[model samples]
Target: MRTSRPWMTQAATRTTAVHIHHQTNDTTWRSYMTIRRAWPCLVFGAACLCPLPIQAQSYPERSIRMIVAFATGASHILAIALSEKLRESLGQGVVPDFRPGAGGNLASALAAKAPTDGYTLLLTSPTIAISPSLFKNLGYDTFRDFTPISLLATVPNVLVVHPSVPAKSLKELIALAKAHPHKLNFGSGGVGSGSQLGSELFKALAKIDIVHVPYKGASIALTAMLGGEVDMVVSTVPATIPFINSGRMRGLAVLAPERVASLPKVPTTAEAGMPQVVVITWYGMFTRAGVKPEIVERLNTEIVKALRMPDIRASFAKVGLDTAPTTSAEFARFLREETDKWARVIRDADIRVN
Candidate 1:
């Protein structure tokens, strides 16, 4: 050790302490910097390694439930055909589940509360619009409770009389009803049913006093007609076309703007001099409200495509249905118009159901 001046000795001691403190500070700072730089990368790596539950780009991952509020057969044959086609388009099993009752008001109420997902849908007729005015106090608001995905098509009703009724044509039926007054009875599926409205329209237009006999369903009404328990029926062409051809019933006039392809020889209500007697029972698809617009659009597109398929078109034609699909907005507009038109008819005719 070398001897030094007092100030130099003090300075050396202080410099050693400063150098140690500086080294400690530098080490701590380096450690902190290393941790800070590695933390973000570590977090990013972990995020990339973990699985996230993201929604699929496409929808309808599971089987879809279609609520059918009516019976099967020619009555629902076209709807069934369309459902099968929709299944193919959606890459999912679209099943029809029937729960028919209350003029389809029951199924409508159930569908209104179903999940907003596209999995649940309603395959029903235009009775949806009429029900609002038909029923005094229904559980759901027809227009607000559901979303109309697409208008499938309209099935024109035909005025048909039982062979025993003695009415050869629409003209003869009007004359007979006018002569017979309240004694000329007509049967319908039920009070406020599409058939009932069709009959009412005919009565209103022809200015006749015909009694309406309500049955449980269209089949029942047709059976009553065949058994001579009822005088006549204004039902769908498909429902009564075979009977008409078999001579059990006589096709008077079609309740369409034009004659149906299946019944070309038959005249339209318009051509029969009763243009206001038109009543078409339309069928379509509706989804639960709050469904995403994208899903609704997808469903509408698939339905329109399904309706246009040649086989589907032929199926509807065979059943005397006009197979056409309308957009959501268009369907909404049609529903409003139909509701208004029928409201006037119902009010004017004093139509009521028990």
Candidate 2:
């Protein structure tokens, strides 16, 4: 929104000053005209390039505080992972504050009241976007109270089964579940979690009946799978990738539009002949609204750079997270679209939380 940059103005002033002085000296004037004729206006790569603003130079004068919506869920893990890379890029420690409760409302409420100095931020999942639709009284307006910085990554929920299960693919799993009725058990992190919603969407699309088993967290749900307490678990790639890769758990399908690069052999639900079965669990970063536009752009630039690093990309890919960095404006648009989409799903499913 800011078109006039102070640095660009300063650069243009210097260019004018030099040209004015050259007008008085015949030799200098000839040199300036020759250079100008060769380079033209826009192509003039003179010392007239704009530098970064002074305010951006001093950003994060101290440690940046990142607030997480979940105490020990994927949001916290993602914040920790990105913090390491962010600290390396910004030269300041990016601290994570876990304020988990109220179905992610507590963190958003606190972040809304935090200073708009770019120090305090929120790292959240679809819960924040889904709050308005799921709850009767959401404390903070997601679109109004926050400035979306970047979409950190898109983590697909995989339909994973213990090796003992007979189903080898998503279609096979559906057929088997249909025949077995309520005999099959599907695990989730908890009620209303991405894992749960993804599993529910699968049931509605595939028309299979599998009892839902809610665990305290994703780690425990995964543990239940390893112990044979649950037949299948539709969890994030981060929690299921290692087990799936090691042959301990078989990946039936990914709940994304396309096959994941990390799990190349696994087909997407759409590729498995069920294009309606799509569930995306994502991670995103947001600063309090009303922060300076320049600082917001600077944060996006550095964060995007960090995500582009080879080591960072590998670490995220290893867990089945696709690096999806975007401009602040683009992220804002995405947030609105996701909020609208989840609203319809929650309303149609009659999802409710106390």
User: Best TM-score goes to which candidate?
Assistant: 1
Q: What tens digits encode model 2's per-residue C-alpha lDDT throughout 1-354?
A: 110000000011111321211001233324433532453242223214754578977887889999998877557657888888789878999998999887678999899999899999898877888777776667788888999998787766778999999999988988999999999988877767667777776776566788989898777988999999999988776677789989999999876655666678888776788654556777788999999987887787777777767887777665556666666775776677667655655554556665
Q: What's the distance in Å from true for residue 273, model 2? A: 1.3
TM-score of 1: 0.77
lDDT of each: 0.71, 0.72
TM-score of each: 0.77, 0.74
lDDT of 1 by residue, 7-94 (tens): 0000111113212110112233244346434644553464467532233236779898988877765336755786788788778898
Query: Which stretches of model 2 miss by more than 4 angstroms?
Result: 1-63, 70-93, 162-165, 179-183, 227-229, 245-248, 318-320
Q: What's the C-alpha lDDT at position 235 in model 2? A: 78
Look at candidate 2 and tell me the lDDT of residue 78.
77
Clashing pairs in 2: none
